[model samples]
Target: MMKYHPLPAFLSACAVSACLFGGHAQAASWKAFSAEGGQAPAPLVLPDLAGRDVDLSAFKGEVVLVNFWATWCEPCREEMPSLQRLQQKLGGRGLRVLAVNVGEGVPRIKQFLERTPVSLTMLRDADSDVMKAWRVRMLPASFLVDRHGMLRYQIVGEADYDDPAQQAPVLELLK
Candidate 1:
């Protein structure tokens, strides 16, 4: 007979609750990265859909929004179009949005793109190494890096990038 462990299941439920409720409350706000005791992020280099290497360091002089997401995540899907719009509205102002897809293949990501088009730079973390390196524990996680490449603000749930309140932090970093 197999033994059942309640501890693991309880912990799993707690994690899910945290992701669904704890983070959801902050969706409309940006949390200062430094307040979380976060420092400059580690180096990141991943391949785009075309397999070309995209390095985070390359965008040092510009504000970069690094978002970790997966196609199956509902919140991730909901916020994608807003992210694209944000890029379009601010790309000329030195704001770059890097949507990092976690642990998904090219075919799946391509399919998602076909259904919901987005022009933001789509990077792949096939092995989830970059995701782990960035300590992303939940879907739709975002971190804003300033022009000097310092981590600024972050949010762990869906955010309407089109919202001026949400864009405030990005604009501040750009300045």
Candidate 2:
């Protein structure tokens, strides 16, 4: 029982190190975060369509789904109604959705709203600062923030909000 091989010795050391470092890396597997298509929405502060401050901190006690979009992006146009439906379905269950339109004017957004039933709170980054900050490379970037103002999950492209796979995390946040 006195054998000392370098590889096995290293493995024993690693096992002990892992035991000692247990639970230290609470969040280590997020290096390759993929939300629908790309990275999640960046933490940002912007104004709603009404120009009122709509920062993430303001919705601390609720599950917030912040989606970044634009009027011209076809995918953005395609997925909005689903997001609206998601809002309607989960409204009473304590879900807040902020659709942040990047760099589009109020009139354009208002005009786009006329054709869809997107009734959630619509925020506008008129100068695109939030968009850049959030690194939104795609049209419909969505982030699910928990009641504690922490981003829990995100999807970069179009997602069927009604899907159970997507809803599970959201419900968890609400709880």
Tens digits of per-residue lDDT for model 2 on 33-120? 3543233336678877777887788777888888877666555677688788888888789898889887667878888898885788
Model 1: per-residue lDDT, tens digit, 34-120?
Answer: 444347888899999999999999998999999988776677888999999999999999999999987777988888899999999
16, model 2: CA deviation in Å?
A: 50
In model 2, the runs with Cα more than 4 Å from the true position are 1-43
Model 1 weakest 10-residue run by lDDT: 1-10
Q: Estimate each model's TM-score.
A: 0.85, 0.73
As a whole number from 0 to 100, the lDDT of residue 103 in candidate 2 is 68
* Model 1 residue 141 lDDT score: 82
Candidate achieving the largest lDDT: 1
